[model samples]
Target chain A: EAGVVQSPRYKIIEKKQPVAFWCNPISGHNTLYWYRQNLGQGPELLIRYENEEAVDDSQLPKDRFSAERLKGVDSTLKIQPAELGDSAVYLCASSLDLGRNTEAFFGQGTRLTVV
Target chain B: SQQGEEDPQALSIQEGENATMNCSYKTSINNLQWYRQNSGRGLVHLILIRSNEREKHSGRLRVTLDTSKKSSSLLITASRAADTASYFCATDSNTPLVFGKGTRLSVIA
Candidate 1:
């Protein structure tokens, strides 16, 4: 089966501009996740979805960051008026079922560069 | 806040040597997983150990979990130059999966 897919392997935008990343989870997967990884650091969970319901998103910055997993298959993460600090890799992952006790399949990720 | 923290932020070893990495979390978890990431690439799942389990081996990879100490260790035997990458430990709970800062391993050929 095809693994998780993400669009725009790399993106470059000026600071204060809006940017969005897209993700398509694996087939039959019931869980999706969005994470941000900075240089020399591990990925930080931005949001998680159990189908259409966002089960965990407390770490998301509500002021500028927004995410939506429509139809429980594809997801989009948007950052409005992004800052220079927003430059990083945005990763999407998926699992077969249940949130815990499962290994996640990851996408190539979209590397965003905010100047 | 419930994220795992990996010890020895970075490690360098010669090819054919063994490299071990550790991860410690603050809370209980349903399972712990190890992932590897190449430079500027996505991550690949290595292995997972459930809370009720203690050790698991996959090829050259060996994982050990100690719930009593809330820590896990990953051992890679006969390391190769291709093993130069970052290794991360993720803890699973009722909350979202959170990854540790990761340990960069550089294996010299």
Candidate 2:
């Protein structure tokens, strides 16, 4: 089966502009996650979805960052009025279910550069 | 704040040698997983060890978890150049997985 898929592997935009990233998880997967990774650092969870419901999104920056999983099969992460500090890799991951033991598979990620 | 921390931020070794990476975490965890990420790529799951499990192996990869010490170690035997990548350890409790800074391993051929 194909792994998780993400579009626009690389994106460059000016500060104060808006950017969006898309993710398509593996078939039959019921859980999806969005994470951000700064250079030389590990990924930090921004939001998590179990089906169409966002179970955890406390880490997301409400002022500029927004995410949605309308159909529960795919997701979109958007950042409006992007700032210079918002430049980082946005990673999307999925798992078979919300089970604690299930392993999550990740996409290639979209590298967003804000200048 | 990050819950886990990996030691020896970077390592370099020749092919056919063994590579070992260690991870230490604060707070209790239900399970710990190891993942490998090539430069500019997404992470790939390597192995997962439960809190009650001591050791598990998958082909050339071996993982050991010590819940009492709140630490885990990954061993790759007879390493090859293809094994060069950043290895991250993630700890999961009742919440989402928390990752460490990761260790970058370079297996020179």
Candidate 3:
């Protein structure tokens, strides 16, 4: 079985430009997540979805960041008018559910560089 | 706010030696999991220890959790160069799993 997959392993864009990242989760997984990791910090959850419903997304920056999981199998994270501070690795993961015992599979991540 | 933090930001050890990394979290957790990341690649799940459990072993990896201390430790015995990577501990609750800063381990051959 294939693991979680992400597009554009690396991305570079100028500030104020819009950028988007895509993710395709493992088959049969019921939960998906978007996380941002800075240079020396751990990943911070940006949003989480169970099927077509976004169960958690309080950490997402509503002003510039938006995410959607139309069918719940694939997700897209978008940042409009990106800022330098938006540069980081965006990781996507999936699990059977949000259960504590479920192990999440991660993608290589899309590293974004905003100049 | 982040919930977990790993200690000893970096560690260097020789092959065949033992490497231990620690993690502490602020709130109650249903389970704690350890993951390893090589270079800039995705993370691989190493082990998971449930709150009802205190210890778990997977090959050369061992994880111990203390709910009262709100801490967990990962021990890699007889480490090899292949073990060189960043180790992160994630705490799971009803909320999303929160990861720690991670401990970078370098195993010299």
Candidate 4:
């Protein structure tokens, strides 16, 4: 089975511009997650979806960051008026379920560079 | 706040030697998982050890979890150059998995 798939392996945009990243979870996966990883740091959870509902998104910056998962299969994370600090690798992951034993598989994250 | 923290930010070892990385988390967790990521790529799941369990093994990788101490350790035996990557430990606590600042392992051939 294919792992989580993300589009635009790398993206470069100027500050104050809007940017969006896309993700397609693995088939039959019921849980999806978006995470941001900065240089020399671990990934921080941005949002999580259980099916079409965003069950957890407290860490998401509501002011400029928004995310949506339509039909519970694909997801999109958008950042409006991006800032230089917004540059990082956005990773999308999926798991069969939210069960404790399930393992999440990640995509080749979209690295964003805000100039 | 990040839940997990890995020790020895970086490690360098020769092939055929053993590599050990440690991780500690703050709160209770259902399970802990280890993942490896090559530079500029996504993370690959390596192993998952449930809370009730103390030890789990996969091929050359051995994971030990200590719920009492909220810590875990990963041991890679007979390492190879291909094993050079950043290894992260994630704690799943009913919410999304929270990762640690991974340990970068460099296996020299």
User: Each prediction's Cα RMSD?
Assistant: 1.0, 0.9, 0.8, 0.8
Candidate 4 residue runs with Cα over 4 Å from true position: none
Residue ranges of candidate 1 with Cα displaced over 4 Å: none
- Model 3 TM-score (B-chain only): 0.97
C-alpha displacement of B105 in model 2, angstroms?
Answer: 0.4
Model 4 chain A poorest ten-residue lDDT run: A96-105
Provide the lDDT at B99 for model 4: 94
lDDT of 3 by residue, A7-115 (tens): 9899999999999999999998989999999987888999999998999999999999999998778999999989999999999999998846978899999999999
- Candidate 2 residue-wise lDDT, B19-106, digit = tens: 9999999999988999999999999999988888999999999999988899999999999999999999988886757789999999
Of the native A-B interface contacts, what share survives in model 2? 0.67
Find the 10 residues in a row with the least total lDDT in model 2 chain A.
A95-104
| Candidate with better DockQ, 1 vs 2 | 1
* Model 2: colliding residue pairs: none
Candidate 3 iRMS, in Å?
Answer: 1.1
Question: In model 4, what is the error at residue B98, expressed in angstroms?
Answer: 0.6
Docking level of model 3: medium
* Model 1 per-residue lDDT tens digits across residues A90-109: 99999987657778999999
Name the candidate that leads on DockQ: 4
Model 1 chain B — which ten-residue stretch has the worst lDDT? B90-99
Question: Best candidate per lDDT, number?
Answer: 4
lDDT of 3 at A80: 99
